[model samples]
Target chain A: MAHSGINLIFEGQNLPRLLGGLWITIRVALIAIIAGGVLGIFLGVLRTFKNRFLRFILRLYLEFFRIVPTVVLLFLFYYILPKSMNLNLPAAEVATLVFTLWMAAEASDIVRGALISVPQHQVDSGLAIGLNRSQLYYYVLIPQSLKLMLPAMMNLISRIIKTTSLLLLISVLDVINVGQQIIEANQKQYPQGAFWVYGVIFVLYFLICYPFSLLAKKLQKD
Target chain B: MSWQIIQQSLPMFQKGFILTLQMSALGILGAIILGLMCSLCQYFKIPVLKQIVGAYIELSRNTPLLIQLFFIYYGLPGIGLKLSAYTCGIIGLIFLGGSYMAEGFSGGFDGIPNSQIESGKAIGLSQGQLTRYVVFPQGFALSIPALAANIIFLIKETSIFTVIAIPELTNTALDLIGLYYHTNEYLLVLVVGYAIILIPLSIILTWLERRIRYGTFGD
Candidate 1:
């Protein structure tokens, strides 16, 4: 009846439990991407403002967050911020916030790349047709760049899902954390459950991400 | 933020900085060799090996470096294969960085037109000579910017080693908080520490990108 005696995943209900953990991972990753995408679009558009001071301010903001390590950012939000402000925030909130900040920086890069790449000749042609700045961007520029932007964002979707694995570090009960807990609980019976558990975790993640990665490649070719 | 705080921790910061440098240097060295081998495997249509290399690239590229780190650092030990935390961290980073580098080389290979390869063959060069004289030089030029960018990313990634408590820059900052009891100050110091190292490298990357774009390194 057994598939194999050395089957890596647990024999019974643990497979279902592990799937539940993966579901949490998928949920958190989706929320972070959506939130980050929205914020990133705004920041990206804001970065295009003509005023030097505003651009300087945004550049500093985006650059600072971009350079800082994500784990350090995680600690700042999950540990130090709560302790410093004496206001308790849940680990999920911290993970989401850190990821959102990270995604915003990345997304803004995508947006800026898209916007900048709209050829000046195209803009000049739009101007010749009496289109205003908004119309020029709305009708012509964004459409051209949107093709480029979408594929990059698709790449980020997988990136977001992969990154959610880091939630384990902050003690958020994501798939990796759940897998770790399962291993810890059953260490006596299966000391090497880690090999199996983490292997399965890798497969779960690979299944989710590889498709998006392939799609991004396909879109880039298009 | 404090001068005294910064002054007293300079030595400790240097040690951490050196470790970060060592890690990146080793990682880039390993990645170059691994990336070249993988790219050559792809270029030559090495059958099953090519498929394996492609899968490795996808798996390494798509997964989070931290998850890969956990697998190498923790999961391997469970199977009776153990590496020190530093070694595990570096190996994980090399795989991640190498895959990106390999992909870049593949893209670079794509850029070298089929006509060029045909021309090489038309010249009656041997297969080894064709690959040596034809593929690698142009691909290397095309891949330099990507290599530089991958190196920068790998440098930033060394920060992840902090989670495994390897005393890299970010970890050193964490350790500094223990000594100074000034969390925000060390955070600021860590930013400065990283900036001092990364900003120059990025400038070089930009310059290399321009060089490649402007045909300085071209056929």
Candidate 2:
């Protein structure tokens, strides 16, 4: 009754464990995306502000995140931050924090691009119509920018989801971690478990992300 | 931040940096070649191969490199393909980067005007000649920015090669930290190491992109 070969992936609740791990990945990504999206929009708006000092600081912030690899950031947060700050945080929390920051940086860039892409004449007309700055942005700019930003945002969302796989390196028990555990456990019974297990995880990620990518393409076309 | 730890680990970090550079160079070169082939296949609409390339691009792009590395490093051995970690790292990078590069290249291909191709054909150029003369140069120029972005991306992705135990920058930092626990210093070293590599690489690429956009390369 021993499950052999690929069957080892399903044997004794392995599949569910992998699903649970994937759930963690999705949950972290969702939380990061939602929180990061809001922060990103605010930063994006700020990024377009005319103040040179603020823009300079924001540019530094963006470039810092862009230049530093996420894994290094993960270590900085998961290991160094706790010791330095004397705060104990879970690996998942650290993962989420780093991801949220990264997402915000990228999303802000997209938002900034989208906002700037609105025709200058549109802004001028809004201003000439006696719209206040906030009113003009709310009524004239935000709506138009949303369309331009949507496809890119969707693409970013998929990218963030794919990136959550890195959380496993920090020991967050993500889908990859779960797959590894399953493989190690079944190494004797199914020497090929890594192939099937990782293949399945790959498929799971593809199933989740491919739709978003396709949707992004469609949205761009529209 | 203890300066001594950084001083002590300077050699380790340097070795890792060089290794990272070598790996990235090989991976980027391989990816460019693979990407060109794939884009050309798509551009020509080769029968069966086009669909296969399409599927490959999606599969490669959709999955994380970490899992791909895992599959390559741990899984392939099951089928008797056993490869060294360094080989696995390069292969993994090429696999992941190839898709992105293909997209970048195909975008370039798409930018080539229909008239350009038609003109080339009217000029008595054969199919090979048309591809060589008309499409490739213009397409490559158009794709330079995207391809540069992909190059930087692939380089950043080399950070993940640590998972497969390649002695890249991140892995070296992690290893030294594990041994010494001078977390802050090593982390600083890691960031500085990446900064040294990535910042210059990006700056150079941006320069190259600008040159291609406006310099003699464009004309």
Candidate 3:
């Protein structure tokens, strides 16, 4: 057929635009991962400390994130926060903030679990060797916990990437959003464009996430 | 911010809340059935089917429900599969949740010891009888925690149903906000509605898990 649907995806600059949209998704996920990773590791270490009140508050923070859906959080930030706080921010920024907060909450728990899973006797030995608390953690606990947490962290990265699809809801111009735009623009000419467009979006997401998941599985087995 | 606006919107929110619950209940049921089928395929080592299940799990696990919904709601119509938004929402949930539940159930299936199977065989129980009595119970009990988590997760995921124009809680709130610009009030009620449903469900699930664990494994 002269006006076949799949051709619309490659018609002129559509594919490049979609790739650009994918870049936006990747950029947001990367910022969140780096910032959230550092913050989460700190919070996780603090979680294992013997401070009862701090641990209680951290528990509440984690619970809040867990109980609330990410889409709700995204809406809260993207819609309500700007008006309530009377501060203008970009949708992409709001997305980054929400995902970073969500990532921090999840990553902290993973970190806490990894940290605590390390044998207590090792900690005791580190302390028994005239090592300061910071030294003990830096030299002994952090290294051990890193190995335990990496796979979970990789899984979390994929999750953050997948959940970035929700960015389309907040008008973040992600790949899904771009695909919609393409479908709408070509709707008159190519009635069946949506299937190929969304199908491509699906494959794009699968490509990005599959490797992280596979890596997680491999590391988990190790 | 206005109490009157919030009060007026309560009915809309309530209707949406009920829809959310209804959709999630159906989705969860379908997911359990589908997940059980997948787990059974793996448990029995059904040649080609096992490999297909493995691939399906990986594919579904890696993609977000939002894309899957768009593909079905907007895309499938292209290939002559025009389902309603409601049907598509439930289908998407089942497709996504089924994989997760399958993983959870497979974990349970794997946890069932070979010794138990051997013991069942020693008593001359057929494979079907052993699966019904020895395996299903223990595996299901072991899977309670995971299954509960998946249920809660599926419910939370229902929020994205708004994207396809389903009048769920989030959709209702956004609609009210678009109309009245009462973002503050609607958002508050939306959060409260979800908290009311999810928090109690989580607590009750935790309690149920404890009860089941005690009944099955018995400390």
**What tens digits encode model 1's per-residue C-alpha lDDT throughout B100-162?**
889877778778778778989999988899779987777787777778877887888888887
- Per-prediction TM-score to the true structure, in the order listed: 0.90, 0.96, 0.96
Give the clashing pairs for model 1: none
lDDT of 2 by residue, B1-219 (tens): 777778989999999999999999999999999999999899999999999999999999999999899989988898789999999999999999999999999998898878888888888999999888878788888899999989988989999999989999999999998998888899998999999988998999989877775233245
**Chain A TM-scores of all predicted models:** 0.90, 0.96, 0.97
Q: Please give, for residues A1-222, the per-residue lDDT of candidate 2 as tens digits.
A: 254477887688998999999999999999999999999999999999999999999889999999988888898899866797987999999899999999999989999999999999999999999999999989999999999999989989999999999998899988899898898887887888888898899899999999999999899889
Tell me how far the alpha carbon of residue A157 in candidate 1 is from the true structure, in angstroms, after superposition.
Answer: 2.1
Error of 1 at B191 (Å): 2.1
**Model 3 CA lDDT for position A207:** 94
Ranking by DockQ: 3, 2, 1
**TM-score, B chain alone, candidates in order:** 0.92, 0.93, 0.95
Ranking by lDDT: 3, 2, 1
iRMSD per prediction, in order: 1.7, 0.7, 0.8
CAPRI docking class of candidate 1: medium
Q: Could you give the fnat of all candidates in order? A: 0.56, 0.78, 0.85
Give the per-residue Cα lDDT of candidate 2 at B161. Answer: 93
Off by over 4 Å in 1: A1-8, A11-13, A83-87, B118-126, B176-181, B211-219
